[model samples]
Target chain A: MTETGEPEIDLLSHYARSLGIEVSGFEDGVPVLCVSGIDAIEGRPGHFHGGATSGLMETAAYALLRLALHERGEQAQLKPINITVQFLAAAKKEPLFAKARITKLGRRSANVTVEAWQEERDRPRASAVMNVMIARSEPEAT
Target chain B: MEKEAPHRDPANVFDPEKAAPFLFAGGHPGWLGLTYLGHGEDWTEIRLPWREELMGDDVRRVIASGPIFSMLDMGGGIAIWTRARRFVPIATLDMRVDYQRPAGERADVIARCECYRTTRSAAFVRGIAHDGDPDDPVATMAAVYMTIGDFNPAGAKND
Candidate 1:
């Protein structure tokens, strides 16, 4: 966990894990996320769904920002203010992977960049940028 | 290509089977589907069945903007889904849509999407839609996705 300042394990990552999003590893300012095809929350064919995809994008960005904050010993509610996604290709197989990077981290706001890819990195299936708002966690920690 | 009949019933309007490749279930209202028609590696065609519930009073006379956007979003999502994985939940982080023409009741919405490139974590995609001609696109979109979890078809509890 290394001493980043804030409490270890960003709350949002815990929620994402509860929802079944698996975190492979985080290093060099990059957070990696993966999900299998069979475990997809939505979709009818051997393809993924868009709304669900949007949810994933949000999750990845959220996780990256949280990790950055943890490293800085800062705690806050990370809410998405805006997001922009680009669908590059279809995810054909199972076990998709997503990587996230924080483009800019500010006191009240942050911007994150993430990409979803399957198999190889040469071609990405989708990519996104998310703008998030930082606020105090309600109720204060016990 | 088979011509899709305009559905009068909002509840039965979205066909999961027809829109199978692209449709995704689960949302506040629940039961949502989007379809893509015609196909090419770099380009494609799409269509979204009209439903009354997704329409607005002003757009009621025409197809609502939200549904149209949903269709484009779904179409673009499906375009990417076809390449990397099968039947996994994916979510959109953000989307931008350019509406060129107003969707009418009788006229069905259509689109074409392209996946240019992708990295380990994200994919980049682009698409366009039209009523009849590709030259006159009714809508256009660029989107991003986050891939998470396995299909777990039986929805079984892991040991």
Candidate 2:
């Protein structure tokens, strides 16, 4: 188990690793993760696959949630309840970046908002809202 | 019957039956081993078989929502082409997926999506992800896509 200095994420997660997501760094206490546009993730020629965009956003949100949980000393396993995403623009061949923050951490659940961009952070390629149920037990590999 | 189908020719109109292998044969969908189930005039179905790599919740042993999300997106896009009867590049403007229950519990998650409406540049889709019964769906999906350039058969895709 990692401490609370940085967002403690399981780097060995198959799905997250499969997407090639890596922690770039932190900004304003939030972790900004990134994934490259490799051939394994291409969609419709030059555009990012809708699902790939969603996955990145969702993974970023969970990383934030994990950080929040660790700060509270809560070993909660997260289960996604819903996710709504808006694709503002078509994502191109640039490296995709995403960051998220906890909107609300209730007793039984938590809400997170995430944004993804390619180059300019201000011009987000997509944004997402995710809600997950918190299982207050030993956190599993997400 | 699966591998014997002819290669997809870009010149023809869309047919999910013929295009399934081509679309899902590689890239993200193929990497996940998503299967093409069947299709109607306005809808298409695809399945995600269980794999250890697909596990999202290691404790609950559930397939991650991300793969399911991809399955829905692919199925929804194909449904639109099935309705349009032609291939056209489209962008996902927005999509919302609601998990009514948990799926991929050492089983399979199948997505059935229908393109119910299409304007000049936008298409709307709705569908469900279920283990076996559509009535008892694990998740529901709603999405809209904006077609690039002219949406006719002879038009070109914008990027």
Candidate 3:
């Protein structure tokens, strides 16, 4: 585990890989994921697509949950139950950042909140709340 | 306050079928392989075909929720245009998505979004995503979108 108590998370999903998301570093001691808004993720002429923004938020939330589980010495898989995303501003074609925090972690589920921003962290472009189910039995590796 | 007109002028009617390709092609939606399926007066349907790179859990062959959210977002946007009868500049204010179940392996997901209500400044949308059967939805969504610019459908003329 790193100094921030986050486990080494390797994004294995194609969705995250396709977006070219990476663990750039930590912000304010919290782990942050970064992605560049390329033409593939653009919506309007010069704006980032809302869907892609949500994808980044959800992926960030999953990474946080994975770290929390690792810290607790629990082996579990996360299944998304719900996500509520709120768009605050138009995201321009630039680098985007996302971070997540676990609000509540129960035996059967976890609630996480995530935010995405560009240029500045204080002025977030979007935020989302996600509830994910925690399953103990590990599935067969693909 | 006076009630706004429910329908935009016929001259400015927005045809979702004709606009889907232009709006989605070469963008995020196209990258995800989203395609226009069908539409109604106030509703639009779109499809997201299954792809290996989209898997959330490769073991279970389950696709990630991100693509599903993207599909719904696009569907919701198109539904708003269908209802407003014009392509008004808009932005998503909030969207709440509830996942009922993981999509089946190798099943293409279809999303149907309906714009049920609209005010002068905002439009309300609801939708469901299903793999094969519409009755057995994989996820449900409720969203709100706010209009931008001088978007007066009643007075605007189509170019």
Candidate 4:
């Protein structure tokens, strides 16, 4: 695991893990998340749950933000301020994928954009814009 | 095109009690342990109990944003059904959630949604999620849903 740039600790939350979300690697130095259509995240029988997709997208956003924090060698706690999700398509029972990037990274906050897709990357099943507040584990330097 | 399955006749009144079991049985709502609490003419209230497994920030002891977001989405759907009284089929077109604070430690979340307006092909909704007090909410949501009498499970341009 150390050989690769992936973090040694798990980036996903317990709920995400229960839904079968995983860190599938990275895209241009950003972490990507993937999940199989399990019963836990099932929606309308044959489709993925809307909330499950939102969760995966949020996890990806956090993953991207966490990496940035790691790069700065800073330990911080994240507080979600807002998330706006746009449902683009109904997902089927298959491997769902998501990735996020930092649109703006400030000293105490970040804005991220994440997209969830299945099969075709061009066509996203859902996309979200997220704003997170960072509470530093240690006080910022004067 | 997929064949249409037999569905309940469209009515003007919705009963959350009757729909609870079917809606929360085996889907993501089931996994989240969602329950129907009560409803009004155009609104629905649902609950999500506390579970260690659903915590977002382990240290803060707060429920993740995803679960709260999920709850609001489902609550909004039920509200639409309650208002429209026609549970034909609905999809979340867009939702914007603003977090005022995180859920209290080990506190169950209560969400209430209202379908304020409905057109021929869409519904607009608003809701709030709180741990104990409705006055002080953990989050608030504004959403839009596309209502279609004939639902297709395959996919839609805006699902």
- Maximum-lDDT candidate: 4
Q: What is candidate 3's lDDT per residue for B1-159, written digit by digit as tens?
A: 001222233455788777766666677887888888999989999999998888887567876899999999999999988987877778999999999999998889999999998887888999999998999999999999999854465556432
Model 2 lDDT per residue over A25-128, tens place = 77877789888987666676666788888888988988888777877887887888999999998888569999998889998999899999987889999999
Q: Residue B134 error for model 4, in Å?
A: 0.5
Model 3 chain B: ten consecutive residues of lowest lDDT = B1-10
i-RMSD of all predictions: 9.9, 2.7, 4.6, 2.2
Q: Residue by residue across B18-127, what tens digits does model 1's lDDT show?
A: 44542333331123335445554434455666554443332135554445555666666556545433333455555776555566665667767775654444557777
Question: lDDT for every model?
Answer: 0.57, 0.82, 0.84, 0.85
iRMS, candidate 3, in Å: value is: 4.6
DockQ (C-alpha based) per candidate is 0.07, 0.52, 0.61, 0.66
Tens digits of per-residue lDDT, candidate 1, A37-134, equal 54334443456655445455567777677677777776576544555667677666377778878788887888788888888887888887766777
Choose the strongest candidate by DockQ: 4
Report the lDDT tens digits of candidate 4 across residue range A42-129: 8776898789999999999998887788778888888899999999999997889999988999878999999999999999999999
Provide the TM-score of chain B versus the true chain B for each model in turn: 0.65, 0.88, 0.87, 0.86
Model 3 Cα displacement at B80 (Å)? 0.8
Candidate 4 has which clashing residue pairs, if any? none
For model 2, what is the C-alpha lDDT against the true structure?
0.82
Model 2: residues >4 Å from true position, as ranges?
A1-12, A138-142, B1-11, B152-159
Question: Weakest 10 consecutive residues, lDDT, candidate 1 chain B?
Answer: B1-10
> Over 4 Å off in model 1, which ranges?
A2-7, A11-15, A42-44, A136-142, B1-94, B97-159
Estimate the TM-score of every prediction.
0.48, 0.89, 0.90, 0.91
lDDT of 2 at A102: 85
DockQ of 1: 0.07
Tell me how far the alpha carbon of residue B120 in candidate 1 is from the true structure, in angstroms, after superposition. 33
Provide the lDDT at A42 for model 1: 40
Each candidate: RMSD to true structure?
14.3, 5.0, 5.7, 4.7
| lDDT score at residue B62, model 4, on the 0-100 scale | 65
